[model samples]
Target: MTTIRMVGFDADDTLWRSEDYFAAAQSTFESIVGAYVGDDARTTERLYAIEKANLAVFGYGVKGMALSMVEAAIEITESRISSSDLQRIVQMAKEMLRHPVDLLPGVREAVEQVAADYPVVLVTKGDLFHQEAKVRDSGLSHLFRRIEIVSEKDVPTYRRLLEEFAIPPEGFVMVGNSLRSDIAPVLELGGWGVHVPYHLTWEHERQADIPADAARRLRSLTHADELPGALRAIAAG
Candidate 1:
């Protein structure tokens, strides 16, 4: 019988405070560049463009963001951006890397409870160093049987994870906030996806709309503590 033998988690916004830092950093970047570019909206748009363009090359993380910000600033300022201004951009990334990891509400309780029943693993994508650092700092690492910090999270990635762990897709459930990164890929692979929405979402991670069937799999929980019940429902299904 197919059952949830392994539960996979997306580490960023789903588990802790991640996008919040990126949002704050973007605001800082916009302010710095807007001073020279004269229009905050246009500057932000340009930075977004640069970031999207760099995603394939840099994958994702503060370092990529910092490089994109520098490139955007230089272009927006027409090469007039000062050395100090450039340093500020680098500092923004540094602060983000150094920022403390704060686990989201009920994360500890949910992970603890779920770990007691099912072997849970962290399947996250980002800069290896930063993601690993956050997992270590969050103090939730011990709850997971293993950790996967990949360059991207897609159908292939999910398939690979299942193969490595020797778990069938039907016997796995993925829990996360981003539909694009976390939920969609798993659903496409025939695995269950439980989406826990976060208030702040990065524009890049946003998807147009989840499919009707995929939407049905979602469990709208007020907090992570409700994850065990959701998993039980998925298992029973």
Candidate 2:
């Protein structure tokens, strides 16, 4: 019989504070862009549109968001935005990139506890340099058997990772904050999921649709402390 021999974790939000910073940067962005455009709602919408459209090109992380912000600012203001404000936008991204990694409460202990019984892998997607720095800074790197910094989290990616591990999809569990990225795809591939919802999520992540049957294989936990119990429950079933 197949069992949950390996567990995967998503880095942002799930393990640490991420989107909160992004939200703040967006507010900063809105303020910078707001000077030229009076409509806050329109400004935010336009920026998001640009960011989403640029995902394939810029990919994900502070640099991508920074570039998209610069583009959005220019387009929203019709090139009326001054160089000073543009510099401020660049400063915002700089602050984010340099920001320290603050892991969530109980996450370190939770990962340690889970790793005691099963092998764990970090399945995160973002800028390679940023993710590498975060993993090195996390202090929890030694707990993971493998660290996957992916471009995107989808069926194909997960399948490849599982193949590399030589484990079947049904014998794995993915723990994360985004249902779209962490939970749904793994569940679709017959893996179990433990969802630890963060207080803040990106607009793009919030829009992902999980399949109707995903809930049956998913365990939603509010805090990191509850992860081990959820995994035990899955293991028992």
lDDT (tens digit, per residue) of candidate 1 on 65-160: 999999999998999899999999898899999999998989999999999999999999889999889999999999999999999998898988
Candidate 1 segments whose C-alpha is farther than 4 A from its true place: none
Query: lDDT per model, in order?
Result: 0.87, 0.91
- TM for candidate 2 is 0.97
Top of the candidates by lDDT: 2
- After aligning candidate 2 to the native by TM-score, how far in Å is the CA of 43 from where it should be? 0.9
Backbone collisions counted per model:
0, 0
Candidate 1 worst ten-residue window by lDDT = 208-217
